[model samples]
Target: MKASRDDDPRVGLDGRLSWRPAGAADLDAWAALIARTAAVERPVWFERREDLAQILESRKNPTAGNSVLGFDVQGVARAYGRITKNPDGEKALGFGCVDPAWQGTGVGSGLLGWTEARTRQRFAADAATRAAARLRLFTEQQHTHHSALFEGRGYRIVRYYSEMHRPLDGTLPEPILDDGFELVPFGPELYEAVRQAHNDAFRDHWGSEPRDQEAWAFVVNDPLARPDLSAVVVERAGGKVAGYQLASHDAQSAESRGFTEGYTELLGVRPEFRGRGIARALLANAMRRFAAAGMDKAALDVDSENPTGALALYLKMGYVAVNSSMAWDREF
Candidate 1:
C-alpha cells in the first residue's frame, strides 16, 4: 500500500517507492534489513545495530563521505544503502545492501546509481587533491545476482577474499618468538604506534589505506574490542613493535551459528620483521586468549591473492575458508 503523499518520504519519480536520508535513530530498521540478508550462508561480515551506529559515526570525518538513504514502502523502512567515501587514491565507496522484499523494484539500481554519483561528486569537490581515482565496492561472491548486477554496470571483479574460521580448542600453534622479541598486550596508550605499525605492515598490501586517529578509534575501539585479547610483539632490542593482532567479537553472529567466536580484526607484521615468527606469536597469543575467554571459535578474513601467503598459513594453522567474497571495481 502506498502511503499518503504527505506522509511518505520523497517518492520514486514513478510513484513506486520512497526514500529519505537516514540518521542514528534508523539503526534498528537497518539492522532488520541486514538480518534478513545475512540469513543466506556466505562469507560476509555480520553487522549488528551497534556496528551500523559506529560506522555512521566514522563518517563524521570530512574525508569519508557518509550518506544513508533509507528506502521505504508505504511509510515503512524496508531497505537502505550507505556509501562512505574512503581513503582516496582508489576513491572507494562503502558496501550497499537492499531488502529482499524490494529485489525487483529498481531499488538496487537506484541505490548503486546514487553511490556512483555521490562518489563522483565527493571526489570532484577535492579534485585538486585526488590522483588517478578509481571506484570500488565489495560484494559476496556467492551472490551471483549481485556479481551480475555490478558487471552489468561495467564493474569487474578485482579481488577475491575468504572468510576463514578456526575452532578455539586452545590448540593454536604455539607462537615462536626470537630471543630479542616478546609478546605484549596492547594498552590504550599504544594507539598511535599501533596505527603507524598498521600502515607500515600493510604498505605493500593491495587496497591498504592510511588511518588517522578517528579511523583507528572507529574500528579498534568498537564495543567488541578486547584490548586484553589483542597482542603486540615488540623487538626488545629497540622496543619497536614488529607485529600485532587486534581482536574483536561478533557475539551475535557467533551465537546465531551455534558457537561463540572471537575475531582477529587486524593482524600484521611489519616487513622488516616478517621472518622472525612475530606473526605466528601474535596469532597464537590472541587465539589462546580468546579460547581462555570461553570463545568456541576464532575467525578472520583474508585476500585470496595475498602475496604474503597469509591464506596458506591460516590453512596450515587449521583455519578453513568458510565463505568467499569478491571485490568489484570500475574507474571513476
Candidate 2:
C-alpha cells in the first residue's frame, strides 16, 4: 500500500525531499523531527520513543498506509504526518509536523494536504464513517502559525483544553472516601471493570467514544503507565467500580524538562457516583502517591468546557493553568 513518489505532494515542494510511508525503520528519524518541531512552540509535554512506537504499531489504529514521511536528500526525516480513524468511525485524528529548519519550504502544507486526503480516503472506504465523518487536529493556542495553516484549509476551532500543574511540596489533602466507597490500588484483575467504568463515565463527554478492549489494554499497559500510583474507587456494597485515576511517569520528559512530574492521564467517575466525593478522593490519592514516589509535581489536562466541571475541581485542588491547546475540525 505504499504511495508512489510520482504522486507525492512533496515532489514539487522541495526537489530534494522525498515522501513515502513511514515504517519501523523511520522511528528514530521521525521522533527526532517531532522533538525539534515541538521545541519551537514549547509544548507542555513531550512524546517518548516508546510512545511513538506504540502508536505506529497500534492494532486498532494501524498506521500501515495512513502515514507519510518527507525525507531530505541526505536521507534525514524532515516532516511527518499520520491519520487514524477512530474505532467508532465518527472521526479521523490527524497529527503532523515539519522540522523548524524546513518550516517555510511548503513541507508543512504538503504534509497537511496529504493527511487530509488520506482522511477522506479512510472515511470513504468505511461505509459507517462516510456520511458523518470529520478530521480533527490539535495545536497549542500559542502556535499561531499552526492555527493559520489549519484555518486556511477550512478547519475551525471546536474545543479548547487547558494543561494544569500543581506542586506537591505543600500539605496534600487526605483521600476521604464516603462510607460505602473505598479506594483500591489499580491492578490487572480490575482492568476490565475499570475499562467499563471509564466508557460509562465519559459517554456524555464531547468527542469521546467507547474504547474497545484492545484500545483499553493499550492504554493501561503502556510502558510509562504506573499501576502503583493509579487508584480506583469501588463501592463496598456491590464491588462496583465508581471511579478511577490512571497515572503515568515519563523519565525522559522529566529529565528534558528539568522537573519530575506524574501525569494523571485519565480520571473519571461514573455518573451515578458523582457528588459523593469519589472523584476528589481518587485525585487526592493519586497526588499523594505521586509525591510518595518522589515526583516534584502532578499534572493533567482538562477540556475547558467539560460538562462535569472538572476544570473547577482541578483549580480547587491547587492546579493552575500553565498552557492551553485547541482542537480544530474539518468535515469531509
Candidate 3:
C-alpha cells in the first residue's frame, strides 16, 4: 500500500494516531518503552539511561541528515522509527521501538509506513546525483516479526551478518609480531591512521563505505570510546599500516542489561602487513587490554564470511562461536 503524508488522519487508523518529529522531550519516555520491551524480548544491551539519552539527542539534530518519526496519541509517544543517511546517502533505518502494550493497535505499521514515505521522498529529490534510490534496514535474526513486517512493506533482506563470541577464560596462543612493531594506545594522532586502515581493508567488501573525518572523530572522542581498550600502530617499516584494534567496555545499556563483557569492535591490518603476524598481534593486544582493565572476559563479533579470513583469525585468538545472526536480502 502507498504510504500517506500531509497531516492526514490516514497516517494511522482512525484519528487517534499522528506522526511527528521526535524531540528531547520524548527520549525519556521512548527509552522507558525500549527498556520494558527489551526485558521481555531479546537481549537488553543498553545500560545507562544517560547514554541512551545522549545518543537520542544526537539523532534529533537534523543537520546530520538523520530523522526520527514518532507515533503519538493523546500527546504520548507510543512508537518510533529512525533513519540515518549514510555517507553513501542511503537511508539506513535503525532502532525502531514501540510500546508492547500498543503493538497490535497499528502503531508500528503507522510509524514504519510514514518513515518510509518520508525517506523515499527525500531521496527522490536527489536523483540528479544518484539515479537509484536505496533504502536499507537490518534486524536481528531472532526478530521474525520484524523481518515479516519489513517484508510485508517491500523491504527485502539483502545480506546476512552473524554475531559470534568467544570465551576469554580459555587458554590463548601467543601472537607473533614483526620486530619493533608493538601495541600502542589509541590517541588523537592515530585516529586518522586507524580510519584509513579500516577503509582500505574494507574497500571491496559489501557495504564497505568508510566513515568521514567527523564520524571517526566522534568515535575517538566519545565517552564510550576507551583508549586503554584500543590497540594501535606505531611503525610500519614494511610500508603497511602496522596494526590496529578497537576494544571497549559494554555500552551503558549493555552493562545495565547485566552484560559486563568487553568488545573488540574493529581490527585491521594493511595488505602489506598481512601474514606477518600484525593481525594476531592486534588481537592479542585487545584481549590483554581488556583483561588488564579488570574485565573478566571479552568478546568481539566478526562476519563469518569476511573476505579477510577474520573468522579463522578470531578463532585462533581464543574466540569460539557462541551465537550467530544472518543477513538476508531480496530485491525490491
Candidate 4:
C-alpha cells in the first residue's frame, strides 16, 4: 500500500471518517478508544488517560505531527496511530489501534500507511545522522489478525516478549545483597544516578537506547510510580547505583480486573555487577515490598531472548508466563 502524503489529513477511509493529528484535547476520546481496543485485542492491560497524556506531552516525542486519530461521522474516535523515534534515531516504533467494531474495514491499514510515510519522512530528514533505520510494531500472540496485517505489509517478527505474573500471597524470597552492596529506597535524589545505571546496564540489550533526562523523568515521576516499592542497589563504598527496580500500581486496572497488581516497570543490573545476584535481589526485594503494600500479585514483562538470562531468573522467581507478544520490524 502506498503511504499517505505527510501533509494530507485525510487517511482515505472511503470518506467514512475524518482524520486529524491528535492533541491534548482528544485525551479522553483517545483513551476511551484505546480502552475499547484493549478489551478486545489485549485485555490483560490498558493505558490510563494519564498515561496517554504523558506520551502526548513528552518533549522527546513529536506527538503533534506524528500521531493521528480517525473519527467517525458522529465525531467519535475510531482509530489512532503514532510513531516515535528512539534517542539514537536508528528505529521508530509504531503504536495504533482500531475500534473492534471497525476491524476489517480498512481503517487499520490506512493508519499504518500514514505512520509508515511519517516514519520514512522522519528518517529521511535525518539521513545524515543515521545510515540505516527501521520501523517496528508490536502485536500480542493471540492477535492473529494483526500479525496478518503486518506480514502482508512485509514486516517480519524480530523478537518475542513474555508477560509474567507471580502471586504475592505465596511465600516470597528474601533479598540477599552481595558483599559490598546494599539496597536502598528509591528517591528523587537518586534519579539521575539510576538513569545512568539503567542506560549502562541495558547498553547491550536489543533495541535499547540511552534514556535522556526528559524520558527518564517521565517514567520515574509518572503518577502511578511507586517509589516506596522501588529499590536501588548501590556499592557500599562509593554509593553508585549497581542495579535498580522501579514499580507502579494501576488502581484503575485493579478495580476492573478484581485484583491489585504491582508492576515492575523497569529492572536492570549493570554488566559489571552481573552474576553477583543483584538482579535477583532487586526483584525479590520488590516482590516483598509489593506484598507488604497489600498487592495481590507482582507483574513484569521481559524480552524472551534477554542476554542476561532474565527470563530464566523470573521463571525461577515464581513468575509464570501469562501472555506473550511479538515485535515485527521493517528495516530501511
In terms of lDDT, the best-performing candidate is 4
Candidate 2 RMSD to the correct structure = 2.6
**Candidate 4 residue runs with Cα over 4 Å from true position:** 1-14
Model 3, 117-236: lDDT tens digits are 556555655554363545566677777777778788877766666555655565655655767676667877777878888887777666656777766755665556677788776564
lDDT of 4 by residue, 109-142 (tens): 8888887877776777774546466899998899
What is candidate 1's lDDT per residue for 90-155, written digit by digit as tens?
565656677676676777776776667656655665645455545688887778878888999899
Q: What ranking of all candidate models by TM-score puts the best one first? A: 4, 2, 1, 3
Predicted structure with the largest TM-score when compared to the true one: 4
Which of candidates 2 and 4 reaches a greater lDDT?
4
TM-score, prediction 1: 0.88
Q: What is the lDDT of residue 113 in candidate 2?
A: 79
Steric overlap count per candidate: 0, 0, 16, 0
Deviation from native of the Cα of residue 13 in model 4, angstroms: 5.4
TM-score of 3: 0.83
Quick one: ranking by lDDT, best first? 4, 2, 1, 3
TM-score, per-candidate, Cα-based:
0.88, 0.93, 0.83, 0.94
lDDT of 2: 0.86
Superposed model 1: Cα runs more than 4 Å off: 1-15, 40-43, 59-65
Model 4: lDDT to the true structure: 0.87
Please write out the lDDT profile of model 2 over residues 83-192, one tens digit for every residue: 88765568889988888998877778877878877776677678665356688999998889999999999999999999889999999989998899889989999999
